[model samples]
Target: MRYSDCGGLLKISFLGKPRIEFNQQDITKEFGSKAIALLCLLMINRNGYCNREKILAYLWPNSNDKSAKYNLRFNLWTIKKNVGLDGNGNEFLCVDRERCSINKDYEYQCDIALIKDLLDDNIDDLEDLETMRHFFNGELLEGYYFKECNEFNEVIIYERNLFEVAKVKLLLRLAKQYENRGDLDSCLNTLEETVKFAPYDEDIVLKIMEIYELQDKNSLAVIYYNTYKNRLVNLLGTQPSKKLTAKFYELSKRPSKGVKLGKTDFDTNNKQRICIKTKCINGIKYFWMASVIKSLLEVEGLQLEDYLTDTQLRDLSYIQPDIANSLGETSARTEVPDVRIAVAFVKLIEKISDSIRLKIIILAENEMDDFSRSLYEYLQDMRLHVDLISE
Candidate 1:
């Protein structure tokens, strides 16, 4: 059967929401709910055709055959009235006494069809990849429901699940491409979205943690590790793989002391010094330095409460600028020292411990910026023992 002899284009959108347009005008409302359901039924079937008897029974199962046939006729009339007619006054549906189907010759666009085409095509460009992603705005006819149409609902659910899986796979493919290009930020952003689709996928969680570590954001790496561990334990009654757990432990370890202070033989009063140096320090680095200090003090059996004030501990938990902005802020100060605060707390630890040892560990060989360079110069003038690590 031919339904497009009128030479105008028909568009049906069934992804996320369902709508029908003809010549760029919305004609979906012109048909009743039953009529739209009938169109969907025919569209979903491979042949785009259904016998009149089967269509009537599926749509109006409680009605007698005669009553159901009458309702089907009314629905068909409504559908043809809005969709069949073209600008030249031609029809798009091929109807007869035995069967109804969209005209095989009719030109049309459908989101489901688009998805199939995308799946089959060799996608080579970002524009096409983005376009394919757009087709899955949400589940099929997400909020549209017919109270008694069980068959239609079944088709909707099956198609929604199928498309959701396809969307996730596509996202993973795209994210891998970003990772391959060393675009860590974009790779991370994409994976964050992918996690929403497959929240329990430990592989995705591990990839995110790995990215955080590569960025030198050990604090975030630890946070994601704990979050995923808890999710797995709570939801699945199991723990993450030992390999992942071991990696987490490795990342959480205190930074190795690379510099050695001279022998403690000269000090008679039992006084000691502690120093930390980094060419560039952001919020993550600052927090990591604090963690290392805490771990060192714990190893020495020092009581944290006795050494650092509550305010100092609070400052150690200061929020990173990116995190603060993500939480939405009206005004936030940027004057907080990215490295000096860490130094101040180390000094506090020194003051509280007479037998402490001073050792400076520098993470970067070259200063990152002007401010960090100045800090490095100041530390140099102090003649502190500095150990610079090669990045």
Candidate 2:
């Protein structure tokens, strides 16, 4: 993976092995434990030079002699061997007698690299904010919580906290867009993730309550509403706003005018038949397709196992009208299957009619192997609408 900053970019690669290839073709390798320690020290000093004596003292405090130099030399040589040379045939991690610096010629793409950028609001590079979110796995070098690395660890932690703040802001923006479009499911998912980052935001909590009401989920709506009201009263010494109180009263007085209420037969079963299949798992495609179906179309009692058959592929299937209606469909009808081999899942999206859509989620990892892609392309040529979802 690649990350960048103002001074330069940090590049990391994992092929047969893991290595950091710096700008000057300076390489850090995983040759042994000692080598790893050396690399970590260099990373900690990414912005400046670390004198040889200081490096040696950091790694081996008591010892001072040819043995220590020899150990450092061996690891350095390993690092050079692993990372290729730079444009001028110079190694990136280098020492000229006494001083050494991680070369700034090459771009650096560390998670920390983007932190400073985010703070700068360099509008030219604002698009990189999203890239910043992916680099943070946890507290920087979480396992190496030594006192010597504490300062460096603090920098990483501070940067990660900033990225999280940015992520929550981004999610809120997306949630608003989804809400305006009346896509309650997508809106709720976005806000729910947002809550994980900023749970104390009453505005977000209110949005969640509104979405629940829109979905006619009054029970869930009531719970969050009460929680919101209680929090305001206990923490701020005030009740829920008049607007919010009135909304709760209106919602509690009558049945939810929820869209598509009596649409699916399984509404009471807790397992609604979103779709009807002539058979189940009739073929390999059918078997894998079952997984995606279960994930996308959720009816309380509906399941794929009931319709799968022994054949690898099949002819027709059906869905309960009510379940289809919940997903913006008006009716149901039997039709030919629509299958696609995705990177990770087998997707079957069928149109019950012109307006109704049926989607099946199938879990199949690496279904897009070299050969599979060619076959998939042929299937596409035949007008089969197969898509890939890696997650």
Candidate 3:
């Protein structure tokens, strides 16, 4: 269902799964990948032209056996039919012999762009941000991975990263809102939830940890630090920054009534192991790869049950993390991940540390963005210090 955003407001969501929820509404209807891709492409090139060739290049790049044109027409017809624009010739999908573009005259507002604008303006009103967030339900057509769909992959990744930044910004905004409302519990809860969704986000996690520490919830802070530390190491093959480690170290040295979970650190002696598999069919390559690294450094003989699934996709890739500690990378490079590497990564990390471990699987071939890269390094360093501990 489409919501008119002529002026009221548009909230955008591109998180776990892709859906577009109207303002103040939790109800969301699923959208097909084709439709979502079309919308996203149009929104990206909103003021520009997106002809049939562009759509075909993105949606059906591999089909060339004489029926490619037919397939293209069929797909476009399918999209237009679903949008209910063809019957009335509303110009939603304009085709002019050799060119096509989304009708520019219609009143359309992109939730993604609208939300960014609000944040950029630094609007202090919680209601306003919440109103914007109402439009978000999930990621941009999530879980619709296809090897012959680079255009889709690229666009979705771009939006996913943007959405992530928005999520963090929203959390900060919400935290401030709750704090102002004199609801420390709600404020803390919002930060905690934000941490779960973005475990690699240390700044937010640190903020939450600091709040907890200030509130004398040292145990909670310790728990979060340990969990976040493990998550970083397993995914990015690095450790936490010196500043974060110092905080955790300072906290550890403090007297506490909290139960110690396990060894706080994990080793990083083993090199990160990565295996990639690729297949090319009809000039389109399907790529898949898996990377395994250390989890935590200090615990002895502790094992975490494998919990892996696709959570976030950025830069033509989706990330699968094992429970909370290790990370696995899987991409359109291959439809299937290298399970052997995943299993090995888990086994190695489990036996080595009591701290949280992460197994990450990402679907993209390139390095992660700067934000994710920093997180990976911080976690890895945390694991190193843990491993150096002599029990």
Candidate 4:
């Protein structure tokens, strides 16, 4: 008898997947596929109704009217039993001599119905538009198929195609709304989602590249163009459009100034060398820094090595001894340069003992939480010169 936040309403979902719920509890497992199929048919029809003849024709075209009617009756009974009835023994379905339909008084919500309602409202309502966009998790009953029913399959396919088109339109509209408001980030996010649904869509790809260019992320623009081109060639065996190719060529021609970390001159062939250690080598800032550092090292005939591989860093017990030997066992465990990584790094330095004055670089200083900052301070206390760079 417990009710969900959605109240006591029966909720049915046919978009992307199929499910039936009452008061937030899934009851779909109680019904057979045929029973669910029948329910879906009735729910989709106008007025939530379908005639017995048409239902039989669509569901069992191979069978005669008598057999089809018998099967339909059994499915209806199963559906009713699964859905249950009111105190008056009236089922959720309203049944006439030759037709079956959902009872008008039944409290229920359907995803498709909600989508239709949203579409009927003013598209200017950004909230409603976003809601509509999210409601389309995927195509209608995406993977569900009715056996021996080509008509039913056709219906599902048609509805899926229609809904997919609608979803793309909705995304484009939402992207435009974001663009108009000068929210490039939101616009890019919307377009990214849209591209998933239409990877080969030149217009969307162009817009995404344009946004990246506007944001002064020319490298990202070039990367995206290359990825799209590879996908096009692999998937469609075609090349990018002339305009897109031209834009990509233009972006590629832009000189790479490389990432700048403070006012340090990397061009000098001084004896000083630097190694960067990061907790996680992900994210745009980390990537840029790594690229810049790599380029600088190549120019200066130097190499940066990882102190510990991901697996080695996971074992705290093994690293504790090495860290204690370097920073003293009495050092507060709260120190920066993670003891595990730092210890491994010190080992590398000792192994490569030479006359190379090495400096340590830590990318993304501002992003580090308290623990990371403590590690940085610990390294400084050890008299190891550490350059903390922030994006």
- Among the numbered candidates, top TM-score falls to 4
Ten contiguous residues with the weakest lDDT in model 2: 351-360
Clashes of each: 5, 49, 49, 3
lDDT of 1 by residue, 1-391 (tens): 1112222567887787678898788987887778877887777663567888888767887788789889998988888777755555556788899988877566677777656656657443554555666677887777878788777677778877887887877777777777778988888888888888898888888888888888776545665676577567767999999778888777766343332232111123322333444334452344434433443443321334444554454444352333233234444344556564655555454543433454545555443444434444555565443333334
lDDT of 2 by residue, 1-391 (tens): 2233243323652211334546545454445655655665576566788888766666655555787677767877876666555545545675677865666664444444444445446332323534554444444344443345444445546644765786676667667767777889988988877887885676787788789878876545554565556556656787776677777665555442332311222223112222322212322443333333434345432222222221212222232233344444455435533441231222223221111222222234445334334443444464433333333
Let me know the TM-score candidate 1 reaches against the reference structure: 0.58
TM-score of 2: 0.42
Encode model 4's per-residue lDDT on 1-391: one tens digit a residue: 1112222247788887688887567988887777877887887773757988889988988998789989999998887776765434445888888899988666666777666655556355566678777678777776778888999889878878877777887888898888888899899989988997888999999999898788776655665676677568867899999999999777766644433322121213322233344432333322322233333334322222223333332332232333333333443234334555445444444322232334445455555555435444554566543444443
TM-score of every prediction relative to native: 0.58, 0.42, 0.52, 0.59
**Predicted candidate 3 versus true structure: per-residue lDDT over 1-391, tens digit per residue:** 2233333222234445655433344323534566566666766665677777777788778878356668666656754554442222354556666766666654335566566667778876777766665666666556767677887688778777877778777877888898788777878988876775677777887777777777765544665666666667788878877777778766655543322333222224221111212211222222122122222222222323322222322211322233223224332323335343334333344333344333333433243444333333444565531221111
Candidate 3, lDDT over the whole model: 0.52
lDDT agreement with native, every candidate = 0.62, 0.50, 0.52, 0.63
